[model samples]
Target: SGAAPRVDPRLLAEGIEASRRAAGAQASRLSPTAAPRQVPNEPVHQDGLRGLVERYWDNPLQLERVLIGQVQPGPLSPTEQAQLGRLLVEKHLSADRGRTLSRIGDEQRNYPNLARALGRSFQAGALTDGHLGYLLGPQGLGTSSRRGFEYTGIATLVAASGSPALQSTTATRSWELGAKQTERHAAVDFHTAAMRATGGSTEATQVLLQQAGPALIAAVDAVADLSRRAPVHPYTNRFSTALGTLLTGLSHLPSSQATNPVGARIVGHLSEQHLTAPALRKGFFDYLRSARTSRSWRGLGPASGNAFTQQELLTRFKDPAIRNHIVTEQYYRMSQALEELLPGQASWATFAVWASRQAGSAIRGEPLAGASGTNANGVRAISHGNTLGASEIAPLFGAFAQTLRSNPDASFQEVWRAAGAPNKPLLREAFQNYFEAYQLRRSGGGADAIAERVLVANTLVAQHEQTALQADIDSAMRVQGVSMWSLELDIPGRVLDLNEDLTGQFPPELRYLRNPRARQLEQQFGGWGDSRMESLFNLFRLNQRDAALHGDWVV
Candidate 1:
């Protein structure tokens, strides 16, 4: 024999404990007092290693504290720390698999300590590409019955580690794995893999883009081709969704710097060939329109049989819920990409036109209470329009304004240039009108004007139903609740009696002549005074106050 084989005592001890753990038995027969105490808020030590590894593998916070030296454990060798780090990464990958990778990546971004620890272990020989691949892979979270892939986590890790080998391996494995999946799933995988490839160091990201960019574009094209081949298939719907996701990812990639030549080239290709393509735009809208019709109204039972088409279902049932959801999601994604890439006239015009249509639909559907009962047609129309306006239009306009504010340095000329220099005056005018409208809406005056209109409408309604309105007001006044300053302020008995009497009138109005001393007292000590009473007094005194002030009521 060349030499007598020997095993270290520490290795033997560790192996025995590991075996005991594997067999679901106690690692040692040490007495309770002799056993190490695992105190709370203490640094993990070698004594706590087993429990730490077993219990804290999935607990990112605790694991992070230990790795970052926040928790003072008794003692751990470098090797032991590395082992723990490796174990944590492995467990996280296992726990995180099949879930949306982007979400997992977002979570990882928040836990830099964990990433640092994993990176350290990776630098050492403790973790390999296989371990990283699993951690950074497109494997998603789900049971054998249902599985899903996520790429965000992998992207985050690749970015954090800045490892060329890991990036390359993740890219290759993602493509291979996705190729075996359905077209929609594969598209998702490819998109996420592309995102991950574009992460990491400048050199690494460049290398990945050069290697993986063409493949990603080709994959996207293939999905589009498949959609064309089977336009009516349900899979085409999924493909459309995937394409939206893919375009979103591509549009959001980091802008190129001097060091990122490959990224610039890749972005240029995507921008020219895919993002700005008329075909892609048409595809997105067409898919969304088709999706509206494809929804199944299974809940309607027999009634659904007659409404086989989406339009037929809508016409029969007058339900806009499905349409609203589908349209909002699809249009929101498209608008987001447009704002990011185009960012001016074209994007604003698209949103404005869509919003106008939505508003028109809503106005046409405005409900009217009828003599027979509730007008179902009016109710349905109003409900549909309101849903679209509230969910989609408002958010789109808000986002447009926010995008402009956030990119103040991006001038009209720049935006026009970026948008391929479309009709300048038309764009300039659109920008001006949009900003003016946005400013007006943001000012409190718009809300006040709407409130005034509503008040007038309510007054007209009350005029027609005087008796009913009086009775409602009388009932409400009787149930008057205590105010925030109930203990400090008390209403005079005569004032309460007067208010009760006023409530019985069709349009109750009360006014108090200006008493400087009383007014001063009210202003100084009436923090929780009755708002309705104040409003009534103000309304009655409005003309007098305006005449005295030489304008509208001052306060």
Candidate 2:
């Protein structure tokens, strides 16, 4: 405290009166209106997009104007169109941007267009599915009188009606729009046109069968042409009958084998389509179940009478043609699963050990138990591996392989290409391998049930594959140090693909669920509700409470 005080002694006030008088004199000379200079906010360099973005990002109206201007510039090229989407997003979203932004703009400037266009195509001259008009038709009147169909909404509707590729997508889109504000009569008209045009696709046909609402009138006549093709639609008196319209449609679609329930073999690259029988079955049955119990069809009036007896439903379900689809679909799933259970490029040698075990199990007639307690169905459950060798089965498999030599997949196909052909023992056993694959959690394949399930599904196996089969057998048998091989596809199927297909079709709301590859819902959700959100979710699944009361197949 004393240190500064020493220098601050009042003795240093050399000019107390002099400074006060001098400062007062100086202040008297200065003006009271003096102000500091100001500078404008102009960038040192020329402003481009980045500068503009940095300048006015805080202002919403100005940003919108910039965005509108960007969209202008006399229509962007297809390549530019794609880059602009990400570029615009980046300019607006300031937070998630940095080096990546610059790289996207610079590195990918010339990349192909990735953003798909979602609308009618001028190149294809495509229209909406069925040009749906309002169903303002009066009750108890001819449908035509009540239907408010019109081609007058837009110049495109009339033009589109004539030049179009019949697809159900637009109609489906309109149905999905359901009263959304942006969708207008144009959407309805487009849907009608699209619906009217589709005769080649099952998707379109199913859309027609299930279609309702204002646009349905427009599709009604188009669907009328399909009346003789699908009998259970528009006027089926029962819920099951109406639902079976899909089967009828499948039966009539061009190139569909009349004997098989499935149409066109769902040939595509979707992994989900190839595997997960349970998920597929669950999805199928769940859809049927929802439709069966729906109080109203498409939210129209009350659903058609469910007056059909349980036995009647069962009878329809058990129809050979219907069951054929069920069985074949199961087999398809089984083949896919078995193929997956095999190996990828991995040599057959890798699978021989497991194959031997399965062969032993098959030979002894003692089914091995799996995680599902007493799961003895073996390959039928996709739980156990398919065995390739045994005293009784090897000879027959060789014979079966002989038949499949010419098939490219070498995988079993579900169609019955040869009718009235003499049955080979291999046909029976091979079919038995997949027959019970679709049964509810396989319902525990009893000896008698197993015997009954060995129904025939002969298509791919034939004389040509004999050499390939023998070669494959020799390759794996060499690995086992004895005779053994996998009775699976030479190629491995992708399980991810199966799960993908199973979940891909889910509504947007369900897209987030953990993709479970269960062959049965019980396998996936069986032990849920004990903890996690399950207990809370149980409240919403009250409908499933009665699951135990019905037969597993029915459930």
Candidate 3:
């Protein structure tokens, strides 16, 4: 009898989300237009849940009535799910996970209806991680029992050795535009099942992950290639988000739960083949970093879930390999961007130019904001091109360059970690702190206060603190160019997108300054920094400054 995981899988099952009807259930459901039924006198808060658990200590049957009945009818926020999990743990509600083995036995011996429905749901991609995790646990998808063999449809769908598997003849016709959609759904189902079952039972998810690895890798290559080759595919919009989820799930799987072979096949293959490539990596990461996508806190997954949260799915770059790749790819793009400006065929000059651009951008916002190769003599506020300016981009990326230069031999991952995991240095903040420290230099000054908050910097972010500081300073340094400072500093490489449009495929909001509306509006307001801009600028600056000076600013 295996002990349960730190978080109860039952809570994950029922508590994950309440509004979503479990897909593929044999039980009849209300019509789509029907109003949801609420459980009478259902627990509405944490205290209410705790009291119910305590009162029903020995009465699991009665206790589950409301939990299932209530959740089956409505939705639970991630907060509620977390609270339920904590209560279960605190109240010692967990039992031997093997306790589910008997249910599998009962189902296989007497009634296979429920079993078949769950199996069909899994095969059809109707279940997600939380649903599958719960099914593999207390809901009884089987532990190590022979009854588990009946769920081979789920495994077979994963092997994708059958039709509609994307590589197969039936799934490849040009008219069958939904081919990519089918493959992605199935892959999501199997990968999620592997993560869930691994958390619950060793034998099940291991077999799942091990079996799914080769097919998944193949599918990854195929779908990514097909999406690129035929961007007009009906499901083209979902390719990046779906692919991101797969890589993220694999990365989040701890080696302790998954076999080393599984990790090597999936993680290693993904990192080398997909992530190492520029366009593929960009598309995947764009999905992760994107805020304007269809994925949101309400429904969670890019592929609608049976029951889950965005926090639960985390298709957003959960893998460290991806993170490491992002660092490597950043420099790679930087090198490429710097190449056109490099002197004709100098062996070592590219790196030097890249370094200089880093310096030039950091100190004075350089190359004067032009397209990929042109260097004009004007404002360097991150134009649509090769120049690396700090004006429009965040200051944190500059810090990554600063960190990388100081530690020449460190791995990108190590360098980012040392610089601070998820933060880019706020240059103006750094400048202000450095100056403040200089004032107190005799006393060996300390910026004890603003040292640990990433939120404050985003405040520099939305407030356009760095933008204003750069524009004001660069307004003067256009002639002589401001000299670089903070040469030895390092910040989070994950902070900014290097102000480069890594993928030309993202939504307009993600495109930011590169969009047409901004330009048109600016033009209408009287060209650069005209009537329409001052009021907005003054609004952010004055309000933000007021909040900052009064110590009322917060994330």
Say which candidate scores most in lDDT: 1
lDDT tens per residue, model 1, 258-310: 21232222222222123223323343333333321232222112221332222
Residue-level lDDT tens digits of model 2 in 157-241: 2122222222344334434543342434333433333333232235555564355433443333332233233333222211112
Misplaced by over 4 Å in model 2 are 1-143, 146-316, 343-555
User: Please, what is the TM-score per model?
Assistant: 0.32, 0.20, 0.26
Name the TM-score of candidate 1: 0.32
Q: Give the total clashing residue pairs for model 2.
A: 33
Candidate 2: TM-score?
0.20
Where is model 2 poorest over a 10-residue stretch in terms of lDDT?
Answer: 134-143
Predicted candidate 3 versus true structure: per-residue lDDT over 1-555, tens digit per residue: 233224343453343233233322223343323343433222435444454445443333433343344423233323333344345423431443323322332223232322333333333443334432343333433343432231222222222211112112111111122222354544433333233222122233334445554454454454455334433332222333234434433333343323333322332223333443443354344433321222221222222223222223223343433433233333333332222222111111122223233343443333433212322332232221112222123223434444445654445455345535544444444333322322333244332221211112223332343344455335324533321211211121211122222222322222223324333433433222422133222222222211112110111
Higher-lDDT candidate of 1 and 2? 1
What's the lDDT for residue 357 in model 1? 32
Predicted candidate 3, C-alpha RMSD = 20.6
Task: Give stretches of model 1 more than 4 Å off.
Answer: 1-50, 74-81, 92-104, 133-149, 162-165, 179-184, 219-555
lDDT of every predicted structure (CA atoms): 0.38, 0.27, 0.31
